[model samples]
Target chain A: MAEKKMGLHTIKLKNPPSILSTATIVGPKEGEGPLKDYFDIVLEDDLFGEKSWEKAESKMLREAVRLAMNKINLSPDQVDYFFAGDLLNQIISSSFAARELGIPFFGLYGACSTLTEAMSLAAMMVDGGFADITIAATSSHFSSAERQFRFPLEHGNQRPPTSQWTVTGAGAVVLGREGKGPYVTYITTGRVVDFGIKDANNMGAAMAPAAADTILRHLKDTGFTAADYDLIMTGDLAKIGREIAADIIKQNGYDITTKFTDAGIEIFDLTTQDVHSGGSGCGCSASVFGGYIYKQLINGNLNRIMIISTGALLSPTSTQQGESIPGIAHAITIERSLEK
Target chain B: MEKRKENEIKNIYQQMVQKKVPQSSLIKDAIFAFVVGGLICDVGQFFMNLFLSFGISKDDVGYYVATVMVFLGAFLTGLGVYDNIGKYAGAGSIVPITGFANSIVSPAMEYKREGYIFGVGSKMFVIAGPILVYGISSSIIVGIIYYLVKVLAR
Candidate 1:
């Protein structure tokens, strides 16, 4: 098992876990976005028939997991492990969802990178003979996040242009030991990197260096260049962080300009959406990957892709107490199996 | 040496962030604040005039105008329109008595989900608490200072 480990922080999976199915559920705002057609469920209202935004967020994750399970006619009992998280205090969205799904759960918190983090862990579990099947899932709600992080939902305050709109969505993916293609091939876990960013509003800028660092490390560890993957997507760096990350990567001898994109940027129409930076939160990458990118893979349009989700680890109290925001990212490489 | 390196790193990253992150348009914000704020004040003035025309005393007119303005702010917030105005209006909508009402009512409304006592009742003053704390305490300090000055002059 030690020999499976790649250089530094990366590992090359011996028996890659194949993604059997995926389910993405998004709010109307995202349903109206560019990749609208890829989502399995587009909620009419954000409430999802729940009284509170927190409950609705949990319901979204629950519904996403059930829907993913239903896609392959798999039951909750069939799922060996459920790894999930969300951008809520105590990760209530995931914990509540776990209680409903009743699959042996591991509640994770890596901020917005939680989905990728879950997937990395789930894939490892499947590959190591620890589990035959595992589920990776996460969610985030705009209203819930705003209340917990910044201000009240109806607070009469202006957001800075650098502020990102948390993508209100949830997504779940089922990874199994047995599947035909689109396997989780490599795992690159990121280290916490802080460049002394104090502003919570401009998280993209804070997380950019971490995103770039992960990408660079993944490439070096695997001895693969940027040209290897069909696409390399960062989680929620949005417009500001995406540019900074790509620039940093280019400066460090790896040119990923053309092949690089971000889940935040692609999930919204930048000009018309009015989401200053772009879409973010845990669901940004989760929904996009489950809805859009997975479709591309299944259709054989994209043979190989690397997804690196960036996260800004900071609480309101931490920012209030004058602490710099630390950022982390996790990269998961999924490739279509070349076997006939 | 470690602190110096940390500071150097902080300085370089701050520079990059400043360059990349889009700045709020001060000119646009100023204009929006001015127009919206002026419009709100105009409504207050209109109410004051109408109340005075009804043979109400000048001393009582001020009370009526203030009450009406505060009511309007709370009302707009309930209708979910004040935040829309605040989004673009910035200080225009936020500086007025209406903004103060908004500051109180918005949290109460948001925390309604948590329950009436803990959520709405307790958190309602979360945002407005600081204003009251400083505003009233400062006035008391001024009052004591005024009294001392009067005593000293006598």
Candidate 2:
């Protein structure tokens, strides 16, 4: 007997329109009243100060998770599992944050790509029936990251043109059974690629090749072309990185033209701002995905989208050892709704 | 529940503000390092913006910025400022372009006593070489496509 062909069992979002509740906590904008109704918690602390950044970052993550759970009408106990990570030493911020959330947690690290990685995993878990609800989150504070990874914010250091402004914020998103919102339909994971560039300051160029590599894989795996989605976005590959990614894609015989954009470059109005290329940090993608794109989804301006979060896997020790900067990118296909 | 975390933070803050390590006070050192490091980046940005105003294309900005940063980083390393910054700010001094330069050169300089070819010369470009290679290659490939588009569009 021929087996009946069932419709695609990919994690499909149920409602055609998905509402996003977002919270942004930047050092400059801390202490402000509620960013929005759905967003309830906002913590004010600088990670780079002589104070304890990990502690503050942990609290921020907890706050973001708490708000996300409340906004989604889910209890912390009800969130079957927590998938989270951050740009902290040993991902301690994520681990600690998850501890407070009190959910079964799986800690992940993809540098700035942590949010998308969380989303991809959470979607699969929900789709596989391992969990009915999950939360994906990430946080990065410029001061804290700088002190731990670079120079202190008060230091009179110079940044390279390829540098990105690591953002100071944490964002969370809750995923559930395809009821109402964007569904993670497919994912393409990329192998790390290093073209021997070791300048951590110039991360965009270091990470672009990986972005190009994964986007190509994504199109191939899903049998979808650039036209399949209205927008194709890459995470944290700022201005220079985006240009490099575009060039690589063009060389590979696919031209994204003006339609393709990178979140790092798009997040800020560069002309009016000194954030040379654009924003970086785990929050760079997390906030853009949760705050900006999620809104567009609810507005029905976007139906299908492919988001590839690119990460530069460089550490202080590796940079010191003269090792090349290797990059990894993860892509997730999102549809407007899961239900037919 | 939140009060415990807040109290913990207060204790850490008090310790950081009051205590001095062997070389200097932790808070003083950290603050000094951060200020100096930030000023360096501010100056770099100023000049970079200046070059852009002088009509330098964005394509060449990275190399120029890198060169200037290398000089400053090497100078800081020589003055022992970077080391002090490291003691205080920890990762702060190491995360910027200058820090990257220090990472590349300090090792190469240490290895110079061993030999030039395997040590200084070869190791000098350890951190930035592959990125340049890939970047240049990708740019050239893209440039060729742009040329083709220009001709084909006509």
Candidate 3:
């Protein structure tokens, strides 16, 4: 019989797909941040020699995909599938990058949760014997996101303290069916949760509950406690959301304060960076996982980790039309082999 | 039954979300707006004095000073400096004639990619359109009332 489905949303892969190589490229602000050394490329100029911020983002994603492929010594043509997404309208950055790559592409949109969503799908394809190797990638640019979601950079609009800076970067990971590396074991998909939050500036508050809900459901479905993993990372929830998520999770009978860390808070030093809340965006988690988390896993510094990336799914039109922001979180568990 | 269940879930979610929303300080925001707005007006006043010293008639000084200020605003917006000022100063940067200049130039620049006529020209008034409509309409109405009162008095 087929492998047992533990819970409604959880997927347990029988032959877990291994992450072969990963790459990250970040803009100057992100490069200056605490995780600067972890990134593969820290661009001096955000434009990256491109005419527009949108083009620059596409270039960053393409370069990340190339860099990841180079690390694995495999060409783009060898990869079976390419999954990518970004925060831009129609996800132009990913689609444009895919045009240059000339691969079988599946464009995804999960806002900041794109990384975990892409990773989960890529792992499923590899584990189900549908593909040998696949690549999951996502990107975001500060200027591009500002113009699309908030105000034009030229507006000089004041940002509230709760507002998080969109990290300007791209991250890519190559997953293979057979590899001696960190294995993706399980994935838990989250439902859309809207708590009547209408302020687009305060995304942390909007997405925190979804993060908590997913983490709780994943633990129950997989029969794993918070203590089971060395680290439990949430994508781009920043400081405020992280605290709220912790509170909700604690009330649900799981306390992950000691094990929990957020990509938004980890990417930037809140005290010094002037990023009022923390780093955020599709790139926030993507770059963090590719640059820092993956390195720790490969180096054996961390044995098991659960990444729960959260997203605030609000469009410019929706926000303007007085619609509350809906949030979603997707979780993936990756583990290192004991024998290795 | 399904509709009721959905409403129940939404209510629970709303309560949870309400508890987490960050408190925004009105006093702090107002102070930022006041200071920034005041500073912009000061710059306009400085320009007015400079124009007056140029020996232009006092009657013409108002027009010249306003023209200079508007030009400066547009120029700075093009250079991408005005936006930075707007960010920190918030409403302060926006309350002045300079902010009006920024509002026009910003959308024009953004839509420049779509071509001059369709993109830049069409979108130029996106932010300022409503303000212009009301401003001109109100002045016309006031003018009509003054004219009617004068005719009736005579």
Clash count of each predicted structure: 0, 41, 3
Model 3 chain A: ten consecutive residues of lowest lDDT = A1-10
Please report the TM-score between candidate 2 and the true structure: 0.64
Ordering by lDDT: 1, 3, 2
Order of candidate numbers by DockQ, starting with the best: 1, 3, 2
* Model 1 stretches with alpha carbons more than 4 Å out: none
lDDT of 3 by residue, B1-71 (tens): 99788778778866765666666677877788798788878888898888878888888888887888789
Task: Give the per-residue lDDT digits (tens) of candidate 1, residues B78-117.
Answer: 9999999999999999999999999999999999988999
Ten residues in sequence with the least summed lDDT for candidate 2 chain A: A1-10
Query: Please, what are the lDDT tens digits per residue for candidate 2 over residues B18-94?
Result: 23111224576567667867877897898799889989999998788788888988787766576556544554676
What interface-residue Cα RMSD does candidate 1 give after superposition?
1.0
True contacts kept of each: 0.79, 0.00, 0.62
Give candidate 3 misplaced runs (Cα > 4 Å): A1-4, A338-340, B1-25, B53-59, B140-154
What are the Cα lDDT values of the candidates?
0.94, 0.70, 0.90
Local accuracy of candidate 2 as per-residue lDDT tens digits, A111-180? 9888878887887677667787778888887766875677533333445445678776778888777456
Worst 10 residues of 1 chain A by lDDT: A331-340
Total clashes for model 3 = 3
Candidate 3, fnat value? Answer: 0.62
What shift in Å separates residue B101 of candidate 3 from its native position after superposition? 1.1
Pitting candidate 1 against candidate 2, the one with the higher DockQ is 1
Between the candidate structures 2 and 3, which one is better when assessed by lDDT? 3
Model 1 Cα lDDT, one tens digit per residue, A1-340? 3879988989989899999999999999999999999999999999999999999999999999999999999999999999999999899999999988899999999999998999999999999999999999999999999999977877788989889999999999999999987999999998999999988989999999999999999999999997788999998999999999998898899999999999999999999988989999999999999999999999999989999999999999999899999999999999987462
